[model samples]
Target: MGSVTTTEQDLRARAEEVLSTLAGEDARLREDQWTAIEALVAQHRRALVVQRTGWGKSAVYFVATALLREQGAGPTVIVSPLLALMRNQIDAAIRAGIVAVTVNSANNDEWDAVYADIENGDVDVLLVSPERLNNPDFRDRVLPKLAASAGMLVVDEAHCVSDWGHDFRPDYRRLRTLIVELPSGIPVLATTATANDRVVTDVSEQLDLGTGEQTLVLRGSLDRESLRLAVVPLPTPARRLAWLASKLDEMPGAGIVYTLTVQAAEDVAEFLTERGFAVRSYSGKTAPDERLDAEADLLGNRVKALVATSALGMGFDKPDLGFVVHLGAPASPVAYYQQIGRAGRALERAEVVLLPGREDRDIWAYFASLAFPPEPLVRQTLGVLSDQPLSTASIETRVDLSRTRLEMLLKVLDADGAAKRVKGGWIATGVDWHYDAERHRRVAEARRTEQQAMLDYIATDECRLVFLRRQLDDPDPTPCGRCDTCTGTVWSDDVSADGEAAADERLSRPGVEVPPRKMWPSGMAELGVDVSGKIAAGELAGVGRAIGRLSDIGWGTRLRELLGSEDRPADDVPVPSDVLDAVVRVLAGWGWERRPVGVIGIGSRTRPHQLEHLARRIAEIGRLPLLGTLPPVGEKPGARENSAQRLAAVWGGLDTAALPDLSGVDGPVLLVDDVLDTGWTMTVAARAVRRAGAPEVLPLTLAVDG
Candidate 1:
């Protein structure tokens, strides 16, 4: 029944009635669902329900809401994680004749009316994102009143509250204040589909509400009877693409094809469309309206699948989704389980397959780099904070940290009470904060253990389902008899010649626009440099092109070997002929506003031989003059972590005078580099050339290391 439950006989009958309306005419609460609901309604106790997807967890809350409303309970407050889940919860509540309202980032205009309804008891439930709990205005002006008056509290996707959870979020910790402030005798429910014993224990303790009373935790078996798991080993990205281009249409119904990167999702979707399969690309980069349209098409079976990143995972309510295919493995099995759980929720049988690659570890490592920054960086962030609040961007201008990493650090500090987010920005609370190095070290160790566990899952010969469930610490990890190992089934590795050719062609294709930087980094004046606003158009580097991103599945594979991480500094080598051919093709199709008349190479201290060789070949192939290199004045620019610092290092470090005679050149000069990391090096070089009288500047690179 609903989260707001009651023990009265009439209310019990009403809970069933609401369940029927919400689920179906013959629907009733499952035994475990009833057990959790009764503890909340009858005993005013907290409950944690760890059931698999489609276990009718929503039904418990909806039924309880109806029963408790009959006895004059206030509206329930649900802290949900995603917009999709909130929409689904609202629709589900409507089915049970409950008026549910949501207060989230998307519906700012409706907040006044939503709050008014909550005050009038017109809303049966209110759904919100965890981030909303700490919103300056909402936290200080709205939360305390809402918590005091709330009939019940629900934390959906509750695993996020724990640092050990696979997809931990800092804002979810805000639930602690709400839970503690919630009036006594208000039933509370915390729910999730993916959580190990550690995550469960963490979440259970968090939901205990400091009442010295144990929370009732109902954890069911994670086994999904409808899922048939398998692994299709493709040796290369091309082969993986070929398999999908050929095998996707043959799957039972519409589903999701998961990719580790946004570009991969778009690339896969593009190829699938070219193959005449109805599909769409979904990722964090996709526009909000487009995501909605894509979700609608999938729900209506208008598309075969939405090639997506993890952005499309968690709380997407597609009950009949037929399959989930992974282009690369996640860092941990728990995360993989969360993504695939989106499928087979309602079907009697659904396919789950993994097409993992060796490059998966590289991607995993990139993410690992963002994990809690070193103590020095943490202190640097805190040192910048004071009684006067400063926006994150303002602080970024002074620190040598990327925006993403900076935000993560700030959130962690906010949780530790060393800093607090306010209306203006963030300010230091002056709290004596200990680094808690031991706790952070243990968390890091746990993450490494999880990554190793994912590798183990891929190599395991046991039942795939059993292996996955075991990773989540499932109590009953029996063989499912449906996985490839259990059934002695093997997927053929071969692809049709046409499919293979298409894949090879697509992967081989190269070139992506390398848009030039515009505005100067904020707070440059603070660094004893004087620059602000946009870069003058004459000095700006033209929208250039790169052979491909270092993250792409195709050129990315080759580029990694040539330009990625190096164990030790060594000698330079010549450019591969095939890569040179791709660069020629890229230039041929560039269609620049003005053709480049000469080429200038960016000097590299370590890779000068390789850099000069590529530039000379490009100029020769195009029959253009080979201008001298734009020499480096100091040490070469590496991957500078901070925006302001990266710019400062390259500000006056390029020796434009090394380019023998830019005065004689009249056309846009092609400034070639081996790799483009921050794009500041290119920008600084272009500015120097443009000042030296080149009409315009166009940057060309072998790879973009964004």
Candidate 2:
């Protein structure tokens, strides 16, 4: 509840006892580590000691334990989010000669033994995972049994509780609640290797500690000046591997090559192994023991390098890493910083190489696409998991997906701690229950867009360091005079195939009139044209179908063409080239006359000027349908739902009517449809429209299912 009653002499004596217990004469705490511990003991306050990786975060915990024990307090309970981390710290504690026992799921006997020892004042330190601590049974059955227990709650990797932190674990959210249930004023010490400003705030809020309450200690940015960061762009797959090989040759250190996929990791590792580079691969599928062995080999220099996915470095503390190579683009800067931070931990020179290009971008985009499951698929999955445990059959029956893809999706959910496998089926965890599918999808989309931006960044021939620094939100990025782009060593921006920078010249030349919304103000000026007659009604219906069809087709170039009509000459009005071309193509395919110009209207007879104008107007109407229709007679733009607007609405809900063969009407016209829930309705409409009077119809929609 408060600072240890142990005096400075008592602490020093206990420190000596801990060293003697560990049987190491020179294994003493560094000045910074000792000062941090003393500050914690003196004030009995919460503190944020941001020691860098390999800076002995674990050792500080032991120092606190010794001080607390010397004051005859109960055994200190250290809460961590990860069981692996708890075990790692316990191992380190044993090595440091601290008597510690872990109460985690992996070993029940050890857990009970530790609880009994703590209750009887037999153990000095008690380590438990946050998940174990949250278990109500543990608090009711095990925790209350501890004797004289008023020890501090030392939280490791506190960033996990912060929403803004990259790896947010929802279980951590209940930590504050759990702490409140514990002894009041139990000094809370939170530690992390990395904590940005937002993360720090999160820790403070969740722990109920104010800034003044938190003994703040910040080590300067651990940016290894010796670690050279380079982004290499390879347009194609073959070139990407070649670039990777070249970079690997340049470093040839005990490094790790991280990739976006397990297959990529395996392939890269195999390739390196074949090329006689000592390489071992690690991924989620790699057995835990095997992964640990591989990591140990890499850190111990037994394996020259490790080819891994992002799964390897959760709490890895390797300082001798000479390089951290990203085989593809990571999702965000936070990810990149964490991976790269693994290198140069010893303040030794290292390198962070990124072989990023179009192929890597494509792979990242593909993964991101998986992040956003279709709404129907998500709804179906949720429904299936409603009554029973979720299995492959349930998902397959509910969501139409291949076995391979479904398995990947399930794994992704599992990795994000959304659902956990139980009794051969997936059950939603607390984290999964709170899963906002749409929000996650939006995040995925945003990441994909950002990945594209990163690709653009890599492809650009600009000051690479400046670009990287700016992305990290660095305020004063004086160009690091070292990168290939900064020096004349390499070019940054690539020139177009034609040599000069891509042209931004006059795209629209004179002569052609850009299609206006109303080509025939006089021809069809009336808001409500007489639709009682078969020909007029049929024409209106056909135009409506064509308008609907346009929504489905890709409009990138068309949008540009519309916007491109800016500085064109008067008569040179760009003839809505894009929309006209679309209409002509549709008509030709539908076997229509596909007239060259004059009014392309559907009527028995019309004046030549009117015909030409109708053709133009049809194209214009395709762009913006309400142009020819008038608003309600008394309505203004602000308060108008005119006949034209109402007609457009009706068109969206129209049933295609049979038309009599009209003499003047000709071939295929572009038809726009919004979304294809099922292709049948549009198919039937196309047929009926063609049979009536229109020669042909090409129907398109915005999106369609396979």
Best by TM-score: 1
- Quote the lDDT for 141 in model 2: 68
Worst 10 residues of 1 by lDDT: 2-11
Looking at model 2, which ten-residue stretch has the lowest summed lDDT? Answer: 504-513
lDDT of 1 by residue, 153-256 (tens): 88899999998998888888778767877787888999999999999998988888578898898998998999988888889999999998878877889999
What's the C-alpha lDDT at position 20 in model 2?
A: 53
- lDDT of candidate 2 at residue 639, scale 0 to 100: 13
Question: What C-alpha lDDT do the candidate models reach, one value each?
Answer: 0.86, 0.54
Q: List candidate 2 segments past 4 Å from native.
A: 1-35, 81-84, 103-105, 133-140, 143-150, 209-219, 246-249, 359-706
